[model samples]
Target: MVVQTRADVGDKSQERIADVLRQRFADVGLDLGDDRIRALAAEVAGA
Candidate 1:
């Protein structure tokens, strides 16, 4: 459901959400852990 929610958002909105999620992961001690993945996600979101 969360993945779907992310997927459904507009590109810019998705990037914003992704940023927030990544930050949250960082705070929790296990980040999403890949710059490339984050960049791809951002690019997809920004598409």
Candidate 2:
């Protein structure tokens, strides 16, 4: 899923959000890798 946030969100915050999302997805049996989630997070963060 694409997570859109305010452009002001920092890179580190985006990464932390992505990490949480990764774990949540994993808990549901979806194994979206770090690279993919990180990319999505960055993309939405407008990085």
Candidate 3:
């Protein structure tokens, strides 16, 4: 979602995508760790 959003907005920076993922997930009630979220974001951004 984050990567798609980045592509939609013409922003592909991994750091920016990670930041977006963090902010988006922060509003959710998920139990994932920050490190895990970052890893997922990196993986998605790399793809």
Select the stronger candidate by TM-score from 1 and 3. Answer: 3
lDDT of each: 0.56, 0.65, 0.65
Query: How many steric clashes between backbone atoms does each model show?
Result: 1, 0, 0
How far residue 6's Cα lies from its native spot in candidate 1, in Å, is: 8.0
Q: Per-residue CA lDDT of candidate 1, range 1-47, in tens?
A: 23543565534565565666566556667655567446646665664
User: Ten consecutive residues with minimal summed lDDT in candidate 1?
Assistant: 1-10
Give the candidate order by descending TM-score.
2, 3, 1
Instruction: Give the per-residue Cα lDDT of candidate 2 at 18.
Output: 79
**Superior candidate under TM-score, 1 versus 2:** 2
Q: Each model's TM-score?
A: 0.43, 0.56, 0.55
Candidate 1, after superposition: displacement of residue 47 in Å? 12
Report the error of model 2 at residue 35, Å. 1.1
